[model samples]
Target: MSGSSARFSGSTHLLCCLGAVSSTIVIAMPAGALARQAASPPTLNDPSFDAALPPLDSAAPQPAAPPVPVAPRAPAPDPELIQPLEPIGSADTTPPAPTAEQAGTGDATLRIRYETTVTGLAGFKTDAIEGDLGRQFRALSALIKDGNKAANAAQVKARADEDVQLAQRIMKAAGYYDGIASSTIDLVPGQPGVVRVTLSATPGPRYVLNTITVTGAPPEPTKIARDSLGLKAGQPVDAALIEGSEANVSLQLPQFGYPFAKLGDRDIALDDTVHNADYVLPIDAGAKSRFRNIQTTGDPVFTVSHLNVFPRYKPGDVYDSRLVEDIRQALVATSLFSTVSVEPVKTGVINPDGTEAVDLLVRQTKGPWHSLAATAGYSTGQGATATGSYTWRNLFSPEGALILTAVAGTQEQGGSVTFRRSDAGQRDRTFQTVLAIDNNRYAAYKADTADLSVSLSRTSTPIWQKRWTWSLGAEIVGTNEAGAALTLGGAQPRITYLVGAIPLLLGYDRSDSLLNPTKGFRITAKLSPETSLKGGKVSPYARTLLLATGYYPISPSLVLAARGQVGSIFGTSVDDLAPSRRLYSGGGGSVRGYGYQQLGPKDANNNPIGGRDQTEFAIEARYRFGNYGIVPFIDGGRVGESSTPGLSGMRYGAGIGGRFYTNFGPLRVDVATPIARKPGESVIALYIGIGQAF
Candidate 1:
């Protein structure tokens, strides 16, 4: 046979089989990608697929058209048309033909961008609900969410009926039982593969609740249970809200002495004609219980008398689980115990009064029950330092503790010993006294100080989510500075100051976390009055300070942190006040990007002189990746020599920092540059520590 005749015969054979096509050949896809693509009919040929086929000659003798049957409507190109036909077999050493990513020359095979926009859902704002209906509807389901290729038009059309049913089910779930939905898939005329699936819906009238019935009660006054429940007869019927009534009963019972109460069977019936639902819940509240005697189990750190002072409920009082939880939280806040639990004995035992006894189980932290830590740190501004601390807990029989801490650093060195006493009568009041001696070197001057103080702190949480604290204290301090700059009106080369004072402070904290907070805010204010203990340079004066910090999470991994501080000392000159008592700024804890005390006012000889008034503001945008974070920050501050505050002497600092978060706290490192530095000041600084700078 001639070569031309052979080619014609082969072509005719292919058309004969195509003409007789009736059954479909299912091409198995990789089991991994289960969602098939939905592609519209091929009104236009894809030029890319034409290159993969064998060349057909236009000059070849024609095969007559009568032998090949044809359909009335245009047929969509087979999805398999564009796929590489090379067989995938175990014998091939070369990697299965490069996936789109491996090739990098193109994208995953046959990808098309399509979105199933639902027009009928007006009031439904939830993305999850919208996605659910999209996945259930067949026309949209074949449109893969991954933006990959689409399935053939035949497959999409076959599921049209299922899509209608899916829309009906969606409406019923949303309390529109009488709603009707009609949908159609129409191709965009000029586009080759894109199709729009439009769903027109008439949401029937919403159904309201016909009745909310409770089967058995008596755990409370019955009125309390009804009031707390979210479902009401006149409200629209929401399956989620109706089901929540059972949970409400369970919660309300615990507040009324039935700690072990539970809600039983629930029946919810929907009526189509009236468009209303009947929701019924059965509650089983066990015997009424009262508080009996309390007992403690397991080894405890505090004395029996000290522990006894904590139970707020009396033997005859009604049982309140909330009180139990509050007491548990109170004990946990002490930071002395590793574990704490308060619960009913759970034994079947009942007293003559039919009351149930409770137990407090506490596991004290492992002994030696004391802490001894050695610390070392450094900064470009402060050079290097070494420090140590010895803490004895449960001192004086677990009602108090003694802590002695000594720190010797490049610019500052001090030692302090404190005795702290906790609420002796469980009144939430704590008392502390400190005797300290320190020799400090600053950018201003070097001084030696002897100090003594006693303070009282009372704390309360009016709203369980937040804390409030009030404190009052008294202090006496003596200080001597050598070669310090003269005060605005005082002595020139040397100064000695002695003062006795009273201090008051109020604080509020609602931050969600202590070491790393992403929400909430904290604010604290303090006022202290001082008088000359041994009149030399010191004068009677009042000092006030205010601080505020805020944290907000813009995203799960990003946080916005900010802080502001203002302080003033009235009735005293800058030189008369001890350096430790005067307000100062700069360093890692104050404004970054400046040396310690660099942002504040300077003395005549270019030394950092303490200021009577100070103000500072800082902001940081921190983005975290797992345990690490990058923070870019800006800090601005001013220091004035007088009691009145002004913008003069203002300095600006800016930098980027890093955080390595650990189980204990974040490890902080900051690299900064001064934005308003003078010729004599350092241009750059580095600081390292544990926890956020604030």
Candidate 2:
């Protein structure tokens, strides 16, 4: 075969396959004829046949239909357009790094924003339920909690789906059992990549209570238990309220002498047609009981004998839960227990009055019963002091504590050992004995003193503040003190003195809090009568002090507080009294801007000589925001040479303070300056401590 003929045959075979023609006709011919035939390619009606073959001999090629315009092949989509998802089941469980889309590439539209709405509710419920739904739904919080990072479309849809279920639950809690919630996630119109999530809820009519009933409760406490529940017919059938009220049924019975009361599950019958429900609560209220024998259990620090004194109820006395709760609080105040419970347990014995007798059960779990604490404070005149204490709360058991305390400072150094019994023979009462020795160096005088004291007191704690409190005590003190001579330039000899005193105190507190009262008032009066033997000359004197403080809340976050104090000495001349016993003011606890004992009478050498009378007044405006507070305060005080406390030489201090509130109390920093500058006084005095200054 000729070369031209072979080319023609091969070309025809390739074109046929390329065009996918169903039929082909092949004829052998002379080389010249074949060439001529090939030059004029076979023409068919099929568009593919003509296009697949290159024109033979450009000159002789039939005019091809105007070249069908072909669009330029689109470039392979940039691999960076949509980030490829990371393969699953990888050994590395760490999430793949976010793409530019996820990171929101400087485009606000890329990050998903969501909104929540509650419909078909009025008054406060609309705003309240809307807020609740926002918090309940993950779709609403995820972007915020995650710093508004963009989520993939799939993830966004998944969160919206979950939010629908949460919204419905929220509505049910608000008494709308037939509420429906739906969520939609869609790209914002005309804004590509900007996804919007909407969580919508339509609350049907709220169900109301048709009848509220309680069963299995005895006559005496049945009324009380029902009253305590605070639920009534015609009230909205709120799930949260129902659950809370059910708990009150069991709680109220025990308080009313039904010590063995047990509440069972509640039953509710709903009528969808009327949108109301019938509710029933069953309780097991045991026999009416009176107080009888005392029982102690668990890891109790107190014996049955010692424990019996804590409860106010006596044998044959009707049982009361308030007394039981008081006993529990008293035990907790001892700081000796990790857990404590005081309950009445059935004794199974019937009294002559036909009432069952129940034993008082005290259960306790010991916690860390020993502690070591240290505190330090500083002021312009008082300098700085560091105090440390070691306390063994259960040293003698039964709420007895032994404390060893030491104070070391620039002006004073002392140590003391104390034994205290809490709930001593009576609730909220204490018996304490102290032995102390100190060497003090102040501008007024220098003394080396030893003291022994015994006191019986009813004191208040931060946890259990009492309305009335009192204390009576006796103390004997021996000291050798050196003071300025009677005459200028005379010998200053140290005097040795023995002092005995009977101290009494009475206090009434209407304040709501012990350390941080916002409303109410408190007043305390202290009196001490003493006899001092100095150089074999006996001098009898009486010392008295009165203190009062009040707090008023102007707003939820602002409090107005004021304090006043007065002190006096009688029955002895100031010259004959012990220097340390003399009335004096000025310190962090008195006049804030002055040094310790700086405001009293001064000697010829310009040193404070102390005085027989003192008076002080302070006022503060405390404003708090969240856990922080700011206080502006003013203080004024004076010391007198006579028994009468007056305004003569009244010194005033003013300052602002800052507070950081904590669970325990407010931590405060005060910066005070004397209103009228005095020679040898600091411009600014700083005081740092816990709780309020008052």
Candidate 3:
């Protein structure tokens, strides 16, 4: 047969997500399945991507280290062994662009079938092998998809030989030295340029790690890196772990002042009979170097004041790549730059004392960038509301901005202008001030308020990572409430009084993400002490609140989330406390089963009157399907007139909700009914908004 007529061969592997669980792998195959192979598949590790060559020497067996036991894992659903073909390895870049005629057709039609199976290796190891083999074949198949795949019969036969070589390499990589890969190809009877192919595998015994040897490393300094190698004897021989350790050895040197560090050699000795694999690594730690000055990209907008605040190391300090990264993060966090790169600039031309110079490159943001935000929310108590805000960035500096916000709803309608500044370096301490007027319709009363306030806050994350936030602020509040009705003392409504107040808040967050959390806990507490300065009103008072939220993931796609809150007011009667200042519950953020502020005691008019104390609790079980979530939740809340929070007469609400996850946040909609309804309260309520209810 001519070269063009012979069968061609290729190897490819991909993982397909069984029903779920394992990080799925996907494989593409021809309509007919795998055909013939070229040769023993090429070595598993492509030479171009492997470590600098000259394979290391093999040696006699050495004592092995104790093994680390890994927990068992459930097997993933079997993969899709066959599927319609999809383009792989990207479109081949080798040959000149294929003409339409050639484009419509590919090398003779081929298909791949995986018949590889094994036992004895349990849990992650078993699943790991399956994923690897799938990916390997996927790549091999991709190469054959190239326009230049053997065009002649004899050439195709040669391609088959290459396929054998590739499969052998993959088998070895899987610790299956004795395994075999086989393929059979046939010409389709009625289809021209089409071929039927079948590929199968026999994965043999799994090999375990025997020993590891490290050479060329300074004993004292390399101890930690050497000790922490995650691989252990008795562990399934995994090429990935060995490669990663080899890379780690190379990195450890540079981290400790070695500027031109290198991994000299890597050796893997495989023993077929004993089914054991041993690893050896050689390291080269180049000369130590000091760090010199930092040369910036010279964007003037990133003022020295901004740039100077983030330098962790000065000239003459030990060279640390980590410090360079810190500088990069600081620059990026300032939101002043659109791009940032911090790296060594002159290690090649080292200083007389062997010092390396570094550079911090940045690109400044331009223009008066603006963003608009819109919001719509609904609740059983407040009905529905809408809000809008516009923000201007880089108003005065990179970290300065102003926002204008307006809101109108059943409970409140108002507008405010806020100015913010946050240039306090890496900790992200910010200062903000706001001026506003609003009509607040509380369940207990209605309020007309005018307010001015400024606050400063800092959020910091560090090693041992407390992940806490701290803030302190003061405000001037004046309001008239209770429909200008009588007060607790039965006197005229408490109104027209200037109150000077200061607030201190402390918060800690450990959630993976702010908008939606799968795991972790967050807690926030605030204390506000106010003094009345208006004539005839000496109602000095203190308010305190504490809240905590927790998330526990039951599975990759399921979570259990909960929140609890408690609050109290002291040194003032419920009537003396402004409507907005009093504690209340029964809303989406509180007890969802009831109306907004509906859980607590009511006033003479059967209207919600703010309470001196409030408590709330909520629990939700959430299941996610890709980007969407379904949640069933239950809530309980209590309100009281006593200064101390009372749990009596607690109200309960339960409901189900749907969430559509998005880049910005999750869009949520829920329908709830009061577990124990009051005669006048509505029977059902619907709420819609963004982010988790909390």
Candidate 4:
């Protein structure tokens, strides 16, 4: 019984060992559901086991009994087969393993420090990434992991290279590359990619003018110094100034008769070391020649004696073309010729002394040409009007013009004749005589006046480009008046006053153009005091008037203009003063927005009341079109005691007008509407005239 127990124990131990091995395999290997197959009863089979009991020799050491096979293995399991499969345990599952490189030398606690340098960034505000270094590093690491280290480095390098190039370009653009600092870039390595770059700039060079010299035989060197040569010491150097100065010198030479003079050998040099520039100019005053004689031949209407009066050159006089021009002007001034010419005669030497003499020639236009013209138009105030004029141009010679005009109308009925003669060598100086008589009703007042005056007047040109003109004249004026109270019904007496005054006029005109002044200013001052020498009242009354106007071009074709006029009578009795001396404002020339003579104070009959002292203002906007124009305007004015015209005293009106261009000038037609009027007053009044209101 003891031996039986031992055998059983051995069998149990073998089964336990087998179980342990199975458990290990199950833990390490994959598992799945088991499949069942039909089982056959085991045949106590293997002959090898059955015949394995062989006798041992006495000399052979006895071996330990082998553990009894657990239920005797039926057949060794097929090498490819797994028996009794079971489910896998969680402990045996794990992720795929990493490669050797990623393990990083197998050092678990390694520390990496990284540095970064960025380049080729435009407007790289530090605030944009003040604390974002980690993000940049992560992006770089990803690039390495994606096997694009070389490509990414190239992209970074490209940007940095572009920035470097841009820096150079910017320096050159500013003209400072020669003085500024250079730039560079480099790369650094760490846990993340890094780079370093530097940019530096320096100041550029400055240039100064070292010398400036003028070399030319300028006309009247003193005058040239005063008019040209706008240079000074210690001024900034400029190449343009050299050219400008040369041109100025050339301009002055011609006025002095050196037409062939010219500037030559001009240059400007720049030196870097001294930071200076120099200018040099040379002038050549070629050959000089003088006019020896002058002669002319043409269709002549005047005799040789008449022609001799207009010679440009005289014996033993210096030759000057300007003098020839003066002589032409003199002949034209006589108003006796239509055309004139002066030519240099090269006649053979007279008296065998090589001295040349010249002959003068004069031409006069055919006379007896006459023109008679009449114009008719309608106006609200005048109802209807017609005017006739007769002109005798070049009556006896080209320089003579005679004019006769007559007007018959409900507002104005008058006639006049005038003859004028211009002087030689002068543009505005003229000798004129006039005989005029006018009978008209002006501003509800009636007056008949006659005047005969002879005068010589000269006009001076602008001063300092201020556009002011000065005129001085001497004249004798005579006057007579009748029907002074015919319209006022004896309220004002029928007084006849004759007086004379020596007048001096000062005028300024700043209009952009004489034909159409859209911008600038115009001012006129006239003072005429009576003198006893003319056998008139030394009434101690003097007249002074001032008128000013201003214009502004608001647009290419539109202009805004305004004007003001003020006048006062002093040193004379009101009765002795001529009606023409009376101050009147609201008229065609004064203001178009109001009816002619309809502005200012009114009379008891609701008609316009004229005044001796007047003030007026007007504003208008003019718009121009294809050879035509239109204007919308406003007018305001007052006439009464210069100081006491009260706020309610002024007259106001608004109107619009159209213009048409003619050979003579622009013709104007306008209609004005009064803003405030008495009961039964007309709503509008009309005016017709020529030229701008101002």
Candidate 5:
């Protein structure tokens, strides 16, 4: 009761203060202020009131400013610095979008980026299948080579599907007919935007031939053809081998008297259980024939009768393609035709041996039969020389030729007319007659000579090299030559000599090439017997020479070659023989750094006197690099005073040469210096010519 009475007394005191403040506010306001406020009030539609406040729809839409583009991320890093991601087939296989770095920047950006991987291959088969798959896909894949211009993910899948078929075909070609090939498009992790195309193959046991059969032929002929195909029962059944072997059967049948033989479609039976294939080759062994008459057509370089000489087989001989090839080669050797073909044509005439007679159709297109040629050579002592010739080949037809030749040189000049008949009376034989005159000026002698010679020989040409060759020739000459005086103080006189000579040469060559020999050896022997009439006295003399050359190949590009020559003269005094007829050595083809004919005896004034005998030797190392070659050579030779060649007084020269090889021949340039410099010999000698210096 006391707390309630104290609270009421406090409340009554606060109420009395508020009632006094309320009576003062009523008294302080101007009279009628509340009435005036109620009479003039602001309205909701007033412009001034609305202008002072923001609109209630302030959150509504508004025009936007242009956006700022984000720059592409910088190129990731050097590709080499980045390790290759593991194959997607293994662990993480989720494909990531290609980054700017993976896809390439700017215009070089690939529509699709991927790498090719071949899996499940073994042995030699791996390389083969991989190579084949690479070739096929690179040429045909829309992904790898970007073969499809606008390539995309869909195209990548499509290409992988097509590759499966292509890989299977390749497996079959490699003799795995039961192999299964599959392809997968895999996403490589870490290599963003790049895909991996994995080609996997399970090559079943390689198919092999279980049986080989020849159809449409007799037992004897079938055996012959089957053996020619070179297919064995245990050999792999490769498509390439089968196709090639089938072609071989047709070719070989013609060689075995089946002139009209041909091959038909092949039949193959695959046995999956044993992985074996039974191959049947159907050969159309047309008529077995014998060679009958050979008919000639087209431009005739040789008459029909003359052409018969080329064939190794005569009429009525069994049809052998080899013989046909031989005849064709013989004609080609003549260099008379641009096009040559020899084919068998059925004559509808049957032989008694149940073989038909076939005539050969020989066709030819004539090639150029006339030519003009020129050659140039230079030697230190011999000076420079140029020779030109015009030849009318086949002037009389059947390989008869007429040639006019002229030689112009610093120390010599000559002209000649020659008539040469090739294949004269026999194949590889030639008959030639030459009429010439020459004037020679040299340190050894000065001579003006007239010569008439006839020769029959079988010599090697650039195209054909005969193992055995021989030459028989006769020559008559009238020469006026100057020589040293008989006495030391006497006058040097010019003597007129008449000479008649018979020469015989025999040669055997086992070398690989005539002009550019790389292996084997060659040997040649020459003997010339001469009768000379000088100062009203007749003298008989014989000159002999022997030459041998050998070549050894140390490597495919290097050859070691050596040659030796020995010559002698007998049955004549040195004073009685003409200087031009004496044996001599030195200069380009002999002792290199020495003057021509300057290696023998000398006169009182130190002029060369030539020699009665001579010996020469040269060795070279020929090394080749592509179209060029280099040769380091050494040459040694001596000219002797006696009738027989001796090793004493030999002069040696060493040289290095460079060769520029062309389709026609090697162009040669050599620089040499005498090993022991002589009084009058040059310190250095340079020789330029064509062909190897042999």
Candidate 6:
């Protein structure tokens, strides 16, 4: 029995040992199994315990064996609260998950290192990025941080290249190229992902003026040297200035009649220190001289002695084409000549003293002309009119001319005799005398008048490089009149007076042509103050007239023109004055759309009551078609007593006209409609004339 008990105890010990091993396996193995498989593994595969296994304890436990088999105590709760209950398989294998510290510490440390490296770049000064650079920096920084290292590097290189290109562009913009300053961009090394770039520029050499002198012989040396020298001491030497100076000097010589002067050569020196330059000009003043001889040829109607009447220059006179031109003008003014030409025959050789001799040759055209003209027109102020005139040009002598004109119908019935002499050799003057008589009756008023006048005038044109003409004259006048008075029974007295006066006239005209003035001014002033040493009572009479006009070219085919005129009569008895001395405005030449003399103060019978003073203004725009032109014009004017009329007593008119060009002049035809008039006045009228009104 003792031996039986020993074996039983041993068995009990064995059981205890088994239980401990099982416990350890369940505790440790479940944790690993859970990691491998989400559910608990199947029960361990071991030998099953049967009732027969109790044989070792059968002898000892036989007496105390309970009537019922002790129910197996529930397996101790699993040490791993959650374990894989399914069998392990190849699909369950997986890597161990990372701990929190490993992920957090590792990523944080990497970011810190990257930021530190970026911030530590030596040349990367944040303050240096002020405006656009600051924006670029922000963009670059964000790109680096976002793990775009390749793009960041590309952007950095591209920006560096752009900086270099911009610098080059600036240099080019400043007109500098092919210089050391435009070479390259240098990049300074820095921490990883950071760099600094700098651009250095080298400037080009500056040239200075070395020597400056006048290069060419100018017509007026003093004036040309003063105006044409383009360089000053210590100034920059520019090729353009040198060229311009040379050209200006060359051009200046021609005005002084030195057509052969030239700028021979020029030299310039550059100074590096002060950035200055100097220039030297070589001038060639060639051949100063005079006309050697004069020759004439052509269809000469006049002898050399007669042609000598228009001598341009005497022997040994300075050679001047302009003087020769004056001679040509004198010949043309004679009216005896139709065509004239004067030219200098240039000799090839220059004198030993650098002087030249030229020859003058004259050509002329003889003329014997007869002209017959007839005209018909209607006027509201003058009624219908017809005129015929006959002219014998260059009649008797080369200097003699005569004209006979006759007029009939409404405006006036008149006859005229005129004789003229041009280049009469009386101090280079033109002489003309006229005898005229006219009977004029007005449509507006029952006024009829007759007048006769004899006048002699002398016109002189001097050589002053200006277009000017002056005239002095004396005249005798007489008048007869018969007209109705304001009242029915009162008959206007027939009054007459004889007066003589000397008139002085001054005129300045500058235009491309007399017929069509494109760009210039014309001014005329006349003063007729009677002198006491005359035929009858000098009739204390004085008349003053002023006219000014301007033409502006808008284009080759368009022009703008303006004119103003004022006339006044003083020291005159109204009744004793000749009808021609009265001032009247309102006509094609005054206020365009108005009848002749119809715009001024009027009497009860609508007669243009003559006034002592008159003023008129006109503005016109003309469009040219070949040689002809069309014009639309506006005019304003007034006529009244010098003392009583005010500014409000003015009339205005606007109209359109056309100009046809002929060899003699431009013939103008205008049709105008009165814009403002009295109740009984006509609205439209027509005017025909030759040349500009002014």
Q: Which predicted model would earn the best TM-score? A: 2
lDDT of each: 0.70, 0.79, 0.69, 0.54, 0.81, 0.59
Measured with C-alpha atoms, the lDDT of residue 677 in candidate 6 is 64
Model 3 TM-score? 0.70
When 2 and 3 are scored with lDDT, the better candidate is 2
What lDDT tens digits, residue by residue, belong to model 6 across residues 45-84?
5556553365664456336656876788888887687676
Give the per-residue Cα lDDT of candidate 5 at 37. 44
For candidate 1, the lDDT comes to 0.70
Number of clashing pairs per prediction, in order: 5, 0, 57, 18, 1, 24
TM-score of 1: 0.61
Model 6 bad stretches (over 4 Å): 1-289, 292-300, 303-314, 329-359, 363-365, 369-378, 384-387, 396-398, 426-428, 444-466, 488-492, 530-539, 625-630, 643-646, 660-665
Give lDDT tens digits, candidate 4, residues 182-222.
Answer: 34445555424444445443324433456666566544443
Model 5: weakest 10-residue lDDT segment is 9-18
Can you write out model 1's per-residue Cα lDDT over 312-343, one digit (the tens) per residue?
77766777778777777777766577676666
Select the stronger candidate by TM-score from 3 and 6.
3
TM-score of 5: 0.75
Across residues 477-580, which tens digit of lDDT does each residue of candidate 5 receive? 99999886556666568999999999999999998887778999999999999999998999999999999999999999999999999999999888889988
Q: Please, what are the lDDT tens digits per residue for candidate 2 over residues 10-83? A: 10111111122254789888765444434667656988877988777764646767988899998898778879
TM-score of each: 0.61, 0.80, 0.70, 0.49, 0.75, 0.53
Q: Quick one: best lDDT, which candidate? A: 5
- Return the lDDT, model 4, position 84: 55
> What's the residue-level lDDT of 675 in candidate 4?
74
Q: Rank the candidates by lDDT, best first.
A: 5, 2, 1, 3, 6, 4
Task: Evaluate model 6: give its lDDT.
Answer: 0.59
The order of the candidates by TM-score, greatest first, is 2, 5, 3, 1, 6, 4
Query: In model 3, which range of ten residues has the least summed lDDT?
Result: 1-10
